[model samples]
Target: MSGPKYLGHLNINVRNVEISHEWYTDLLGLHTYDFIPGRAAFLSANVELSHEIALTQVAEGAPGLQPGQVGLGHFAWRVETLDDLKEFYQKLLDRDIKITPRDHGVSMGLYFQDPDGNGVEVYYERVRADWYTQENIFTNEKRPVGDFPGPWDELAAD
Candidate 1:
C-alpha cells in the first residue's frame, strides 16, 4: 500500500516549554508564533510557512525519552546551507547540548538531545540525486566527526 498523505507538523511532549522553546529556536532557527501557558506552544520558520513544530507539556512525573524506545526515534529538519548546520552545531555545543555528528552517505547531520533528552537531528543533504544508485544505499555508517567536509568554507570565500 502507498503511504498516506505528507507529514504535517510534529507535536512533541517536552519537559519544559521555555527551555525547549529556546533550545529549538537557537539550534534550528525557528521563531515562536504562538504560546499557550501550561498547555502548548507553536513555532515556525522565519519564512511564510506555517507552524513547523509544536510543543506540549507532558504530565508531571512522566518518564522522558530513553534509548531503544518503542516510538518516535527522531526527526530531521533539512537545512539549505551547510554553514547553517555548522553554525548551529557550534551554538548547541556552547549550550552544553550533547551532540553526535555523523555523515550519512547522502547527508551530513548533527544529532543532539533536547532539554528533555529527545533526540533531534539537523542535517544538510550533501549528495546530488544523480549520485544515488540501487547498489549504494546511504547507510548510517559511523565515521569520525569533521571527516565530512562541509561546504561552508567554499561558500564563505565567494
Candidate 2:
C-alpha cells in the first residue's frame, strides 16, 4: 500500500512539559509556539505547516519510557541526505545525545533518546532499487549499518 503524502505530527506525553518543549525546539532548530505555561505546548519545524509535534506534560513522578513496555515503538525524522543525517548525528553527539546506529538494508538509522528516555530515530535512505526486496517492497532487514562516520560507527560498519 502507498503511504500518505507525508507524516504530519505526533502527540506525546512527556515527563515534564516545559523540559520536553525546550528539548524538541532545540532539536528541531525551531521555537515553541502556542505554548501554555504548563500542561501542553505545540512545536513546528516550519512556519507553513501546523504543529509538527504536540507535547503534553505527564503527571509528576510517573515512570519514564520503558523499552520493553508495549506502547509507541518510536518516532522518526528523515533528513535531507547522508550529509544531513551526519550533521544531525554530530549535533546530537555534541549535545551528548547517545546514538545507536542500524542498517535496515533500505535505510540507515540512529536510535537515541530524549530527556524522558523516549526513543527517537534519525535516519537516511540509501539507493531504492538496490534495497527493494523481491516481495515488491522495501526490505525490512534489521542489520548492522554502513560505513562513513556516525555515533556507532565501530559496530555499524561491521
- Candidate 2 runs further than 4 Å off: 1-7, 130-158
Q: lDDT scores for all predictions?
A: 0.74, 0.75
- Candidate 2: worst 10 consecutive residues by lDDT? 149-158
What's the residue-level lDDT of 148 in candidate 1?
54
Candidate 1, residues 127-149, lDDT tens digits: the string is 57633443445442432335355
- TM-score of decoy 2: 0.78
Candidate No. with top lDDT: 2
- On residues 65-147, what C-alpha lDDT tens digit does candidate 2 reach at each position? 66589888888877769877777777877787878777666678878888888888888987777664635344445443454
- Lowest lDDT sum, 10 consecutive residues, model 1, at 136-145
What's the residue-level lDDT of 66 in candidate 2?
Answer: 68
